[model samples]
Target: MDPERFQKNAMYVETPEVFDAEKNFDDDGRIKRTGTLTTASAHIITAVIGSGVLSLAWAIAQLGWVAGPAVLLAFSFITYFTSTLLADCYRTPDPVHGKRNYTYSDAVESVLGGNKVKLCGLAQYINLVGVTIGYTITASISMVAVKKSDCFHKHGHQAKCSTSNNPYMILFACMQIVLCQIPNFSKLWWLSILAAVMSFAYSTIGLGLSIAKIAEGAPVRTTLTGVQVGVDVSASDKVWRTFQAIGNIAFAYAYSNVLIEIQDTLKSSPPENKVMKKSSLIGILTTTLFYVLCGCLGYAAFGNDAPGNFLTGFGFYEPFWLIDIANICIAVHLVGAYQVFCQPIFGFVEKWSKEKWSNSEFINAEHEVKLPLCGIYSVNFFRLVWRTAYVIVTAVLAMLFPFFNDFLGLIGSVSFWPLTVYFPIEMYIKQSNMKKFSFTWTWLKILIWVCLIVSLIAAAGSIQGLVQDLRKYKPFQAEQ
Candidate 1:
């Protein structure tokens, strides 16, 4: 069997005997049509909005109101543009052939060939794993906030929470182990929808609370440089801070990792690019609206004192009930967010398993698994263990490197150029067969280069920030 032909034919089968979306069934024996415009929009929204939103205020505070939202809107357009390029690459050979690209790696293999597939796979898993670790850190911190709120009521202590994040991280790992066992991407639709709602809910609440506090005469938070608004700061310090802010904004919109996979879930009849374009537009606009509102209001409310996480930071000043509600929303949403991102990682592992062991028990014939009454889900045995182990490993990493903000910036910077900017534009240029030096082609090259340089600088700054923060506070040590 020719490897190139196998790669193409694997996803784009013309014959029903090979693969068909309609023929795919879920655990409940229902045809698994995971991609509807609405559901796909929800999943995209869920993927885009994560713990990153919590830092938008800090990003804005660093750049101030004007440049902050400006950077955000710029990145939104860039992410949407690149993601559409990805969605367009979802199928190959003309509309009649209608072969689908089911994963980002598959799309890369189809357009860039098998050699580049591994590169895509590597960047993708790193991004996904980094995201999973970020979410674990989020869940644990949110849990710690909730616990500390209870402690505040019990003992009236106002300092940092006495509880460590490790226990809650472990608890979150357990939740992911169960959610990750859902067996197929199609099974996670409701979870995605719920996660979307939770994202909106917390964002809205955070914004509303900020507005209320500002109305009550809360002072604007000061800059990290210890200067009040309008006070002079060094140009070099301001420039570096703005650069870091760009990364935080970029990280907030880092959903390119799962764009292809989400499009794969769409119903096949109408053509995916059409639905995906609409979904991307809706998702980005929705998230952008929330981001602008949350970031602006949060900066206004807290000024330079804004916490990296809006809800967590504002909780110190806001009511406990509101704080608990917001954190709980975060905790619940990360559960589903973890599942959304982990599905691709799970698929990759299963693919490797099947290739290495053709008779592996994990690869489902139709991506379906039935639940038994034995209190154990009837997923493939190997899959259950593999996924469980994956979550456990991420949880441990979260324990070891619990620097959520810095680590998220690092992942975003590392992934933003490759997944979001580089591949999409390159594939678009190649797939579209755009002539060299043409207006659009020239601009695409310029965009790619600019993004690469900016991302590299941001990645370096993130690493530097992580090292400095680590020196001041060792991992696994209780926050003082």
Candidate 2:
């Protein structure tokens, strides 16, 4: 088959079956379907949950409870409106005819052509890199929390502290990559189910404990005072800021690609199954409820001065068992995120290299050309180096920036804005034909403008937060 033509044809098809098969397996030895709506919903929920849950209260507390819900509502509306717009655009393009599978880059290319697409791609690449870094940082923090807990301490606390470097982190990352390399969708589906269960169990237990502590009259510290202090913003300003911060926090919930992938999976399922929409609704509702409960309980228990250390505040202090459980759950969640992040990079690289190395024409054409001796030519070497580097870099970053919510919100808001809000409205404008713009369309345009403006402001806030964090960096400080 012609390489170009084959590539074009494959764009509409689901990801190669081999890749799907490799990632689907449960801890309990069950196989699940990856392309189904249920799995898609799970992916969306898991992606949103990540390590952000740990610091959500801290962020929300900055604005207080009243402002926090407003922020949440605004972001929720933005997500729903923008997503539906994008989904409509996706539906406009016949899934089978043109390139059915559309990425952020594809959407950009369709609207603005090559130059703008390149810019968008760069932004996406940075966002992905930042996300990977954030994931690793969260994983490392979780690992340290587990190590410092009474469970590990009782085993040999002094010795464990002396050898603080976590080998299990590396081992887990490797295991995740290996699992993802498997090419069976059914297996990947099953694994997601187990992951979903583990995630739920961990979150539920932790949340329940947090709520119990709050009910027992735990004192909550107020980080921001309502009275204006010198250079700091007034309480009212802070409240508005918190409302803006909701838009940032809402970025965690933006998982448009996962939704599209899930939609693709459902295409093959029975038409009678309303699983995709139902699962999405269920997942979002479940996650939102959890978020509100955790946020309220955490604030009530730990206040604004919650410790940076895992499971320390929120009344989990001194309970080695609880800490250990939280740590393990967090680590497992990180592994899940790593799998999701790494899959696309792996697929892209694999496809890019296959043609150059495996094609007969390329081989024959290159026969007389001299290849560099030191450069990478062997796929085995590439895989080894790539996997090793991925783990090491991720681990180091995770340790350095353990404040997962800050990083997740910053990166997610910036990157997701264009994909979830701007591009969709742009596509709608380009494709829609109206003799006169209706009131609804006018309202949508206004909403889109608001999203774009708020997105920029939110991105600025997150960037400012990140900068402040970087300025306060202390080396080798123990996880608080």
Candidate 3:
């Protein structure tokens, strides 16, 4: 009667037609990897160039033109360098070969080999969860912007067209519930490609709109030292915002959390490490160029008063249709990027559940339902319940704290030091076993400590911003 209890263990019931054929498996005894340099590059670009790009102009405004671009480049280099180090740890006993570490946590466990395994998993997954929440807030903001753009077009630019982001956040969570059912990271290639294209579309729109605004030849105040004391902001406000700006820039370059997962999708030949390094270079270079142009042009357009998100922040009032299109692209991009980040969390939970309750049929059972055109699909009670619950929780949290820039800055500041910088550096040092306090080791130590200090200051700034936001705003009542 239920039709659910009938189907079970399709993985083991694989027909001869599907299973008997000679299949390719990598050294890890999984499906043959299909990812190439291009796909990896696409994945990196999709992850790195996200809603965070919308804030770069505001980040640039906090620092001056000279320091802004310089800080962006500095973070870019640091991220790329640490990424390369982390890439080599994908394999053990050797950089190019040895036991394969399928995830970032696996790499940390293999190299560092202590309670650090749990630490890595906790930090990585917590950061991933935080990122998905940030995306929820951001996508909803863009969706609200789209509706407001139409209202502003029909009415005047000064019209009170503001709306709360809660409804859009729910809508975004609904979409993620569907997309999150896609199983695993390998199945996300097409989504990554599409999201990469969307990232470019919106970024180009923002850049073009900024150029148009600059061409209008309106005088806007800008300074080499940006937002000086008393003129544009108080001295303490300037300090807090400058640190928060670094956090925003860090958030823009945050592609490392899922680096090993992405690498695992690659074909084993040519060494995943080597290919990943190339992908890193390509992705970082392209995004950096876009960042420099968009951030600088947007600042020049609006000067010290640049909005946190130029496209949605009403930096350009006419050409409302173009602004709507850009916001649409941002929402679409976040849709895919959200899944890209959350799939890892899903995997971790499923793996833990299976291991913890190995014999529980409820956790391991699968029912196959054949459908028209889409073919047979497996439905698991646990996955449906758990994944939906996770998405709902993130949506609720997003509604609670919808301060976009400050939230992004805090998440970035907290995770950047541990996940991006500290863990990678420590893992590389242990894996390579260069002498303690050697030139390389000493410099790497310095880098990690310096990054830790920077992240702490950035996190403090974001906390201050959040405290300020809370003073005047009510939860679930934010409108822009």
Best by lDDT: 3
All-Cα superposition RMSD per candidate: 5.4, 8.0, 3.5
lDDT of 1 at 80: 90
The estimated TM-scores of all candidates read: 0.88, 0.75, 0.95
For residues 3-24, could you state the per-residue lDDT of candidate 3 as single tens digits? 1222343221121233311254
Q: What does candidate 2's lDDT look like per residue over 1-480, in tens digits?
A: 233333222221132333332243222222333466677667667756666665656656666667665665566556655555554443334322334333445555665565767766666666666666666666755666666666444665444343233354456656666654433233355556656665676677667777777788856565433112343466555644553355456666666544443444443333302454566566667777766766666666667654432263324644677667877887777777666655545444545565667653332121111236522222233444455666577666655555544666676767666666766666666656533478867876787777767777777776666666778776556544
Candidate 1 C-alpha lDDT tens digits along 77-108: 99999988888888874422446677888888
The residue pairs that clash in candidate 1, if any, are 35-265, 35-266, 220-303, 221-302, 221-303, 221-304, 221-305, 222-304
TM-score: the better of candidates 1 and 3: 3
Model 3, residue 451: displacement in angstroms? 1.0
Candidate 2 RMSD to the correct structure: 8.0
Candidate 1 contains a number of clashing pairs equal to: 8
- Report the number of backbone clashes for model 2: 20
Per-residue error for 167 in candidate 1, Å, reads 1.2
- What's the candidate order when arranged by decreasing lDDT? 3, 1, 2
Runs off by more than 4 Å, candidate 3: 1-17, 20-24
- Model 3 whole-model lDDT (C-alpha atoms): 0.85
